[model samples]
Structures are given as C-alpha cells and as structure tokens.
Target chain A: MSNTATDSSETTARHNEKMKRIKAARDKMMAGKTEEKGLIIVHTGTGKGKSSSGFGMIMRCIAWGMPCAVVQFIKGTWETGEKRLLQAHFAGECRFFVSGEGFTWETQDRDRDVAAARNGWEIAKQQILDPRIRFVLLDEINIALRYDYLDIDEVVDFLLTQKPPMTHVCLTGRNARPELIEAADLVTEMSLLKHPFRDGVKAQKGVEF
Target chain B: MSNTATDSSETTARHNEKMKRIKAARDKMMAGKTEEKGLIIVHTGTGKGKSSSGFGMIMRCIAWGMPCAVVQFIKGTWETGEKRLLQAHFAGECRFFVSGEGFTWETQDRDRDVAAARNGWEIAKQQILDPRIRFVLLDEINIALRYDYLDIDEVVDFLLTQKPPMTHVCLTGRNARPELIEAADLVTEMSLLKHPFRDGVKAQKGVEF
Candidate 1:
C-alpha cells in the first residue's frame, strides 16, 4: 500500500511536468497560427451525421447570435425535428428553406429534379450574397451536383465571389465534386462503418432527423 | 416566356406528385418499424465532427426533455463551446463529467493516464447504470482505449450489461477497437479529406471548440 501511494504521487508529478511541456509546445505552435478567415466547409461521404453536423454548426452560430440560413436541397417534405426546433427557437435570426421536393429516387423525373435544384440554387445564391447572413448552409447541394442538376463550376464561382469576406458556408451531402473539394477550406467525409438501416432498423425520430 | 412558365408549372405538378408517393412509402416503412431499443452508437475516424455530432444528439435529447450525461475522457482541459452551452442551458437535466487529465500527448505518463481513465470508467459505469439518464455520451473513450489505458473487453462488457434497457450510449473518438465496432448497433467514421488545421489555421471559438 505504501509503495502504491508513493508511486501514485510520483506519477502525478511526472504527469504535471509532461503537461507543462505540452502546453508550452502547443502555445508556441498556436502563436504562429493567427490568420482568421471564413471557412468553406464540406461534409460528404457515406456515413451518418453529414447534415446533422451542419446543423451543429448552426447551433454554434445561434449561440453566438449570428444570422444563418439553411437551404435543404433533397430533404424538405419530412417534418424533421431540427426544422421544428430551429423554427420555434430561432425564427428571426435564421431562415430555413426546403427547396427539394423529395429524394431523387422518389422524384425519378430528371427534368423536374433539375428544375427544383435550380430553384434551390437561386435561393442559395441569394443567401450567399446576403451580407446579413453570416453562415449559409447549402444542405445536400452536393447531391444536386452529383446528379448533374447544378453546374459545379457556377456554384464554385459564386462561392468564390461572395460579398462578405467573413461569411462561412457549409455544404453537406455525399459525393462532393472534385472542384468543390479543391475549393473548400475544410472537408469532412463521414464514412459509414455500420448502419442500422442495413439491419432493417428504420430511421428513428430524434436520432436520424 | 409563356413556354418557360408552362414548363415550370408542369414541373411543379410532377414534383408534388413525386413527393406524395414518397411520403406514403416513408409512412409505410416507418409504420413497420415500431420497436424501440437502446442504441450503441460509435462515432470514430480522423474527421472533425465526431464529438460535434454526438453533442447534436444531446441537443435533440434536450429538446425531448430527456436526462443525459457526458463523461469526457480525453478532452477535459479545453473549455469547449459545447460544454459551456450544455452546462448553461441543460443544467438540471444534464451532468457533464470531465474525467481525463488531458490528451495523451500532453500527459505523456502512461500509468497516470491509466489511473485517470480507470477513474473515468468508474464514473461512466455509474452513469450507464443510472435509471434517470436516457443518453450517456462517452466522449473520446476510444482515445483512452487506443492508448491501452482501459481494457476494451471490460468496457464492452460493462456497456452490454447496462440496467436501463432504454438508455442510448454514444462513444466518440478515432481508432475504435474492432471488438467495440462489432458490438455497436450503429457506427459512423468521420473521415477527414481536408482541415484548416493542416493549413495552419488555429482552432476558432464557436467553430473548432
């Protein structure tokens, strides 16, 4: 017991010393990184939480009292829990636009889907240009691009020409275009390891939404 | 102009019909999935949003008036934005435990880290058994496991034996063990394609934190 106690104290001392060293190193590293700019964030791949993560950023923006807009491309009709919560809590500061009629598989008509996507893009372009909107979430815009509904070059050019220098934009969906990925400041690909849907478990409220 | 207007209206009608069919199909799929059970969710990979996504779920739980607990294993010292927000807003319904001393690279002492991890596990095990807590987030527990501070078998065994059958649990971190993956009900790996940190951008308030 006595040996154990002594060893524990020694361990604490060592841990403290180690932490001090790390803090010093981290502080030094951080000191060199002072540039701050609005990020073009992309969330893509075949996993859960791509759009959910985008909403998380919206939560952060809300906490900071920043004006934000969300234009959901392919997930409009469902009464999502997030839509209800955000609409109720942050009506004035946030604008939620559901542009897509439904999933492409459901729509099936390429022309109709393209028209809907173009409509959403027009709204998204307006949001991106609005200086009042600090964060613009082009939710599932990548899907529209993936399906060739929206011109990738045009979207990229529009993003590059935003008026406000500090307006952050987040695009969430699977199969982000190579051009978008190249232009993005931060990109997170949510890879799927396992999904409940594969096991016949349907989407759950307050979890999937 | 007349042709364009006519085409637009026709597209809208088609989109509406498509959405109606989707809603019906979705309703039928949802109706068949009536069973509700506790989910073992794993959020792992080298991306940025694993913990952020977990916290988003916490927000959902809060909206539903569910009691939740967070046991942060490897991210204790940082004054994360999520921690501040959750603590302030969901004070009574949530319990936030910062159990780890710091990151492994910072601490550097294996024995000390092990002891700290063990201590956190004790708290987590208690939270898991607590009947009142509906959601328990073991934030960065995988990091502790990666460093061999905690036994994967023991952790998995404990999770499998939770008292309350309805308590959902989320484990977040990179390098999740294969055993844990096999046992998880749902798993998402946040794959990193690009990060501002790689470009020497410092972690920003209300964004990275």
Candidate 2:
C-alpha cells in the first residue's frame, strides 16, 4: 500500500466538502429511522453461515446480558464446536435444545422426524413465550418446515403474533418457506459463490462446524 | 403438523429404498473428499450476517481451543457486543484490534485512512504468521480495500502465500474486490432481500450489534 500520496491541501479541501454533503444526507436518513422493534430474521440460502450467523447473534445476546435459547431443529447427534462453546462459556445465559436424527434423507423415518420437530417446537414455544427470554434461534427449522414436519402457518402465527414484541427471533435453513419469508422482518440469503467441498475437500473441523 | 400419516408399509419401503440410494451416492461423494487445508473464506454483499458469520467462526475457533485474532479495519470506535463478549469470556485466547476513523466518506482524509489500513495490515501480518494463531478475522477489510486505502494484490498475496497453511482466515464486508474473490476458496454473498432500515426501522441493540 502507498504510505503517503503527496498530501495535497487543495484536493483534501474538495474531498472534505464532498464528505460534508454525504454526512448531511446520511444524518437526515438516519434521523427518520426512529422505530426500533425486535425483528424476525431469516438466514436462508444454498450457502454456509446460516447457523453460524445465528450462533453469532446468540453471542451478541449473551454479551448484552439477554437470556437466549437455541433450538437445533432436524439436527444430528454429532457434537459441534459452536454448541460446546456456547454451553461452556454462556451456559446459564443461553440454553440449547437439540432434536432429530440428522437430515431428512439420512433419517428416512418421517414419523420419527415429525415427532422430533414437534418436540423441538414445544421447547421453542416455551422459550418464545417466556418473558425472561430475550432471543430465540430456531436453527434449521426451515428444513423441518420444508419436509412438512411442522406447520409453517402455526409457527409463523406464534412468532409474529403470540411472542413478546421485544423478543428477537431468528430462523435459519436452506429453502425457507414463502410464508415464513413473507412474515420475516429481515431476510438474508447467503448465496454460495464457491465452496471448497466442490474441490473434493472435506469440511474442516473448527471452521465448518 | 400432521401427527401421523397412517404408517403405510409400502410407502415406508419406497422411502427407505430411495434414501438408501441417496446415502450410497453421498458416501461415494464423501469418499473422494480427503484434502485438508486452510480456507480463504470471504463474506461480502449488501446484507447482514457478514460480520456475524465471522464472529461465529471465531467462536468456533475458541471453542476448539484455537488462538484467534480479530482486526476491525476502517471502523469507528463503536463498542460491539461481539467484541465485548470475546474480550470478557475469552480474553487470552482471542485478541481484538480496531483501526481507522470510520467509513472512507465519513473520514474524508485519504492519507489518514491509508495509514490506519496499513497499521491494521501490519498487525494482521503478524497474527497470520504466528504459529499459535489458528484463525484471524479481517473484519471489514474489504471496505478499506475498496477505498484504495490498502493494495488488494499485496493483501491477497500475503494471505494466500505467506500465511500458515493450516490457519483459517475470513474477510467480511460488502462490495469485495474481484481480485480478493478470485483468491478465496469459499465466498458467500449475503443478498439483502429485505431490510428493516428501509422501512424506517433502526438497528436493534443486541441483535444488530
């Protein structure tokens, strides 16, 4: 990188003037954004970081001293570093609920999978209703809804209407239902531009988990 | 959710058979994935979760007992919940470094911005070479590169060639340069389908932070 670019006072003055205009516009825009409410955030797409972002949000909630819960829906028994870390570091501050035997194709038992999703939702509902709970991460619940293991309408109704107005909620998974997306306040699609797995590289332990 | 769909023996058999085929194909694909190497992961786009994903990766590293460092480039001195949480829970395991006055348009001083980016890069280089450090998050460095505060080619060469082969790295920001994207192993673009800010909703405290 260039350490210095011949500090020209004349050019600096012009740039400063341009910045002044930008700052004024930005201040005006921000001044209008006065409403602050808990968001129904959806992280869904054919890429990584759906669950990772949820974990990060949980981290933020824990840092700010908010009671949070994570319900890993349609998950496996495999131990994830994120789960271990949250349990170890923020134990009481955050709670974890893991259900299901893995992905749908892997399990191949629709009854068992449906039972698991219902069990997870039971836990999620309790957390969502608890006035003490400030955040809930419905991790991979979209996959359950995709498989018709859970009713999207029922889930959306409880989240958008029954839950406390200030309780933040995040749902993450690939192929999120349209109703859920329509109900979400913020929807971020993590588009997969490139993945190392395509190059015959297995998932790395800490990074992938 | 349907409690049960009348356990049909023939339907169950068909599902089981189809799943077996999928498992076999999945196993064959996984058998070829033997390579294990550090990844240059990039998270960029005009959406949320770029930094959240990076924070989650850092959490993963910490959980797995890997020493990590985070360098917030071109950032203002706003206190983030992620930074505070990392410092409070895993101080010795992870380090935090923040540089720059803020955004390029806001700072309006090219020389000072360049100096700050360079300073952050120097710290990043040290962290990358440190054998003890397993992960480093170059948070918002893309913005610094976008403003020409740091040379993208120089940064890419250092990260791709000089850094330890086993160490993982992540770059987070919107509008990442094409050169950096070319060198990265995994790239996820967080596309903003909907944002609350556009509807006059300010960022939430714990959730957005």
The numbered model that scores best in TM-score is 2
Q: What tens digits encode model 1's per-residue C-alpha lDDT throughout B1-209?
A: 13497786786576667767876887777777766777899999988888888877777776667788999998899877678767766678679998887787677676777888899999998998988888899999999898667989898887887536788899999999999999998999998888887677777654676
Proportion of native contacts present in model 1? 0.44
lDDT of 2 by residue, A1-209 (tens): 32254446566667677877888899899899999787899999998999998899999999999999999996657688888998887789999889877877788776787889999999999998999999999999999998777998899999888989888899999999999999999999999999999998897776888
lDDT by residue for model 1 (A59-129), tens: 77776677899999998787776687678767786899988977876766767778899999999989988
**Scored by Cα lDDT, where does model 1 land?**
0.83
Best by DockQ: 2
DockQ, all models: 0.37, 0.72
Q: After aligning candidate 2 to the native by TM-score, how far in Å is the CA of B127 from where it should be?
A: 0.4
TM-score of each: 0.84, 0.95
What TM-score, to 2 decimals, does candidate 2 have?
Answer: 0.95
Clashing pairs in 1: none
Model 2, B1-209: lDDT tens per residue? 22255546565567677877888899899899999988899999998999999999899888888899999996656678998998888989899888767777787776687889999999999998999988999999999898777889999999878989888889999999999999999999999988999999997777788
Which stretches of candidate 2 lie above 4 Å from their native place?
A1-14, B1-13
